[model samples]
Target: MDYIHLNEMEFYGYHGVFAEETKLGQRFRLTLSLAVDLKQAGETDELKQTVHYGEVYGLCKDVVEGEPKKLLEAVAEQLASRVMEDFPLIKGVRVLLVKPDPPIPGYYKSVAVELTRGIFV
Candidate 1:
């Protein structure tokens, strides 16, 4: 199995439990790892033989920037589920969602949620 990784993809989104957060929005970073068998693509060098990363990025962007969700868990869940559903060749997906500046008063770098979905062989 081979993996395609998209790291630190940034976006602005209105996803939070607080009304102020939803109104103003915040920065989000997403890291996605998709597992697939790359043997066919490696041999044939055909676009159709493997997942198109551009399309995957577009899907992630749409989900991240489109709707207002209350939790990062929901966001991660949606992303993982969509990626698996949209690409049949993908055996699994791991999604990490990071919120750089959470509403908490504590001093910290960021809050993140990581989730994995689908079957791996």
Candidate 2:
């Protein structure tokens, strides 16, 4: 299967269990991988035949920046669902949401959640 990857998307969002964390906000990075067959798009050479990456980006941005969720797992799951729902051609999708510089006691680089969804229902 052919795949398209969108990586290292950054967004400033207010999402945390702590009050200060929510009020101050932090940086989040999202990466998306979509698996699909591009036969129609390749043959026709038409934009409509393939998945609209711009739309996917916009939707991801909207979801990531829209609401404050305590867990990145929820964000990742929601993103996976939206991608599959919006793009019918995609056979599977993987979503990763990373939180950089989390407010933890020790030194930690980041925390993230990875989710995968298949198109078949």
> What CA root-mean-square deviation does each model show from the true structure?
0.9, 2.0
**Cα miss at 79, model 1 (Å)?**
0.5
Model 1, range 1-121, lDDT digits (tens) per residue?
A: 7999999999999999999889999999999999999999999999999999999999999999989899999999999999999999999999999999989899999999998887654
Which regions of candidate 2 are displaced past 4 Å? 119-121
Q: Provide backbone clash counts, one per model.
A: 0, 0
Best by lDDT: 1
Tens-digit lDDT track of model 2 for 1-121? 8888899999988888888778998899999989988888999999988998989999998988879888888878888988999888899998889999788888778888887899522
Alpha-carbon TM-score of each model against the true structure: 0.97, 0.92
- Predicted model with the maximum TM-score: 1
TM-score of 2: 0.92
Worst 10 residues of 1 by lDDT: 112-121
